[model samples]
Target: MKTPGHIRAVSRRTVLKGAAAAAALQLAAPFIIKARGETPLRIGMVDPLTGAYAAVAQNEVMGARLAVQQVNANGGILGRPIELLVEDSANDVGTGVQKARKLIDRDQVTFLIGDVNSGVAQAIAQVTNEKKVLHIVSGGHTDTITGSDCKWNVYRVCNTTSMEANAVADLLFTKYGKKWHFITPDYAYGHTLQKAALADLQKLGGTMTGNELTPLGTTDFSAYLIKARAANPDVLLVLPQGSDMVNCLKQVAQFGIGKQMHVAGLQQELESLEAMPPEARVGIWMFEWYWKQPGVSGVDKFVAEIRKVNNGKVPTARHWFGYTSVHTLAAIANKEKSLDAKKLAEALGGFELADDVKLQPNKCYYRKGDHQLMTSAFVGEALSQPAGDPEDLFRVDRVVAGDKTAPPEAATGCKLQWPT
Candidate 1:
């Protein structure tokens, strides 16, 4: 565990320095694509390319593409060109599982990455582990992915539900009052996030005024908005994400409840912010990464590259997850000189992330205990006024080291079943 004092929230300047260092490491990486007359190493990526989370998933795929391009340019991994095969899970668990099998069994991909939906990610985890193929999830953030349901072949590059919850809970309570009402989704992702948020709130002497659980793919939030208005809590914690998140915030404005209480969420992404109207995008939430925040040495270069490919649009944290997961996987394979699932998993067990990745100043790493990538946690507040840059949606407010946000290993109940 990090010492109690290790996780102090920092200012933008300090965070920028950290970002610069990380980006510097990235810029220094060699990009030579030498051919060694070897067969290409294939990696299968599964994501919801056309659904509620399509925007975020598409950005993730773009990130992965950039990583592959960079690795191939760097003489390919171990002189073998990397080939990526993408499958659309459409945010469904059964479909995701089928796609996973196709990728592993037919495509014969040695590695796998992706899935925005927690349920789909969990299902894919089971498939990948059974096949003994190393799967690195880029966008899935369920606690169980790194907790009780963790598999040796499955690893995550995103923050867990608990980390997301604790990152902003204390700050929200401190800035706004403790009485809270929740607009939670009715699914594995929503339940886990809500539970984590409530636990953190309670720890900080906060109380839950009410909760309205809405079904997934909900279009109309009228009934929930009415109930939330009645509850009139200090903070309205909306936990639905992607299109649902955009819809909920829009409804909050339509209901005129934005002025009545402080609005917040367990997580927020660049896609949702772009989809949201300026009037509806108010409030504070946890952000996995923000492109404009300077710290890593090569972040500006990344942002420029992404913007060029994305038609001048800034890349979100989803993109970072995709890019980092692929690059990290490739780096490990090169270091170990093997793609054996067990060897790859072991290589990543305690691997520390370089400073050029837009996280905290402290070195981040994947905890061997749970296979969770521990990085810095940031809280962002959506701006109500025009910030000139359309991508300038949020003003980053706080930076907390991952060590402080992550729960202690003993508390996670992750029993790794590595092959003996």
Candidate 2:
């Protein structure tokens, strides 16, 4: 556990030098703003093009595209259309760094949105700070990403592992009568989330039987599954995403081990559920940002339009995450009333979102305390397919409010607070 003083909400240090602190201001910078003859709001989204995470990368690209269309249809950001440039980073750290440089130096994007891998996001954050470009991350969640590597130039809009812990921490332990074990990827994000979840579980009177950290692309999980089943824990937290998740489920089902323990965690896309056989995925639970929970205003239309765009097939959760982040970014720039990165960042601190369909506009604001959005996370269970449904998949089971699950200032492990 982080020491009581380790997760300080008050920013203990300053890392952001002002935009004016940058030495070179281009002559075309003035023309880049579009709304009122300011710089055009040039944004870039860097994602994987060819990798295990390709499907998710494509989903992010599509979502950003949708937001650009929506923003333009509604009269673009400020006035000019949000000119977005997308580069394929292929989930490689070096590739993401190179692409970020190209986006900032050659393409002159005012802000950026992606780089799916945490390592890449960290590298890109470094470059963005040196060049003074605002990088809005929709992917990449590690405590240290916002902890030690944090900078004012970088902001995360996705549910951090912090939020996921609050969403699922005591859920299985208390409600489902589950004592837990963790199977996590051997990286910072996975380990961090696992730690937080375990801490939360411990706080709720649960104990972890054991945990196993596996390599990134390990395909065969027979050994791990056997060990987990042998432990006989009531529930398992499987936190791998992409192909690794698909393979783990297949192997878990092949051995019929999940019957011994319930499986639940944060899932990447709906496609992961579809990737498995019926008996394998039944009753598995997960959390996402955009499932259509009951009475969730505007979700039906948002899902409908998304299905329409995808040839009547439901869009993946990743697609909605990317789409929503783009809208959030555009809305912040809109609130800023200019394309200035600093202004947008300043306004992001006070920005709020109502829903997926932009209805009932609320005074939603990003807590300057930690740069986390004051929003909600949707938790869902795998549902049994009805007789005539198009597919057997998961639907949202509950909505967890951001504030409800929000960790206090002492939990983020962040040292810097935004300017109030």
Candidate 3:
């Protein structure tokens, strides 16, 4: 009941009308104050920002932030500014979950983009499923994300391990006629990748000389290199990420693998090789999402912008992946004009960005069956540039469009489905 004074001030007609309106306004004030405390769009990011894949994580963050900037510049999403909340997982599994919880409970983020490592992605997926929160994985691409553990709230924006492993492995065998041996880390990323590569190699009529799974912290590859040397395979696919890749490639010249081995995957990322000496990383083949090649959508502008931001030096390929992932988030948020996680996940199935080059219409989609994205993968070769500059070390040798690499539906073991 409002006071007589409030009733009188509210209206001439017994003041009942103004009393109700005044009471409602008083009630709304608390909600308005609380809303003001929260960010415009609660986007939580968990990544290995301080550890092995920090460079990749940083690149991904830059890309995501760029999307946020672009979206806000165009009058923001649904007329509301988006605020991205980031937390470092330090590449630790426990930290990944902890950070995710903070994002969900404290930051109140409606959606999330993730840890650079597959392990971190896996852990976060479990948490989101349990909490019924949405997770859009931009960096992690392990099969497990879309595999057995794929959850209701989880959707991936990158290819799975099975996709890359089979695609790259088969590509090498068909093109290079592989008598293959592998040098991969013993951890999940390396092992899962090696398994897929080997399977594809065998399917393509290639002989697998053998494989050696080096220890996770094996800084010195002399022993592993010695083993690889003994195998004498035509293809030497290195599956290590982060400093492991850079370190191993540096010593590969001494092992003479460069003389006879065909490098692919991580060994072929141009930025990693730019730090390497000639012959140490040349003719290296690697699979990727985008390169500054003509006809590839969004590549030239993205590359130019990144180069401009990095001051003429090129951003790491991982940076571009992060870049694309960020824009994807903004698109989903802007398309349905909602910050709600479920709506964004549903919108993801048929989503397309007018500016997205790597993802094309109809052809590009998130596999409703497994929650995996069908993104084009590029098989690139390291250019033998004398300058060995970070920006000029590699060029797209082959355009392995998404259509060429995707396996038949009967092949993948995914059981879950999404609406058309």
Candidate 4:
């Protein structure tokens, strides 16, 4: 019924109102986003939190939690809070792979950390590599993690068996005798560790009295001890780790084997030493980290912070491994200002940890070619009695730099291939 001009006017008014509403919504968009908050960056961790490595694995988690707290308190990665989700690997490879897939596919984690057991670590690496997730091997020490089997997306914070062996080989040969026997674990970790040690011993003109391969979780070491004692080696290298090490060392002390021959090992953990009796703690070994470094910068603060969460127990190398792994992701991502896996991986090629994070006297950095952290080894002997502090169970004889202990990257056989 209206005139044509009137109808046109009404349509123009409606159009203007709609345009005004659209402008208002555009103005409100940023505030709505701000109110909704940013999505938190998720990190997945897998470890043997329930099995033989539970004690050490839990310590690693504790360190990781502390790192997350510290990172959020400061500004977090890419200005978003970090959420760490941990899964128990149960010290089994099949279970570890399943958990890794769950973290990658179901939980949608941006970064991955895990596995005190080397076999489980390698299995998890396959998943991480396929998914293109950034992964840091927190405690697994098998050489292949950073050697022949190394992946572009994977980096290791712990020392390889070859590094541990090289750290103490000369000292063991000079101080102890040249004749040696081994109580090695029957997994990839023990196999490579024994091989590396044997190579070092042969190079030093040492003789192997005998070598015994003990299966993982074997509680009865009596038969192995009998064979070792019969051989009458100058040194007995007890190489089993976690609960196995505790059982073997307890039996060794019970048999009074330390009194007959020198007891030594390449890599030893404070978690194992604390679980053992004073007599069973007898050993010359290398600690990837030690808490009682007198003159080292940042060591005191790190120890104090860990004690709050650790029931006043000191931080072990496993703890440092977890802390460094989390910090590695945050530090590199924040520095590069991007969460892209390839970009971050390239940034971390030769990244040096900060002084506070390193906590050792020597320089600590990742080797560019292999992505293995060149952290200092705390070479020392276990103390029967507390040196000063109740938790001080080691007497650090030397702080050897990792560069000196680790072989050349070319020698490691690591060839990193990036996704095309």
- Which lDDT tens digits does candidate 1 get at residues 1-420? 000111122231112122212332242233324467777777888988766777777677778767877878876677787766677898889999999999899878989998898989999999998899999999888899999998998889889999999899988899888999999988888989999999999999989988899987889999998988898899999999989999999999878887899888879987888887888988888888888766657778888877756656777898788888888888888888887889889889998876555334556799989999887777869886756876688888777788789999878879999888
User: What C-alpha lDDT does candidate 3 achieve relative to the native structure?
Assistant: 0.64
Off by over 4 Å in 2: 1-41, 176-178, 356-364, 384-388, 417-420
lDDT of 2 at 66: 62
lDDT string, candidate 2, 116-175, tens digits: 677777788889878877777777777666665667667776667777777766666766
Ten-residue segment with the worst summed lDDT in candidate 2? 19-28
TM-score leaderboard ranking: 4, 1, 2, 3
TM-score of each: 0.90, 0.83, 0.83, 0.91
lDDT of 3 by residue, 29-146 (tens): 1111123333365567787766556556666766665555565566555665565666778777899999889888876777788877888888988787767777878778666667
lDDT of candidate 4 over 45-145, digit per residue (tens): 89887767777887787787777767766777888877677778888999999999998998799999988999999999999999999999999999999
Of 1 and 2, which scores higher on TM-score?
1
lDDT of 3 at 142: 65
Which 10 consecutive positions of candidate 3 have the poorest summed lDDT? 24-33
Residue 377 CA displacement from its true place in model 2, Å = 2.0
Model 4 regions more than 4 Å off: 1-36
- Candidate 1: count the clashes: 24
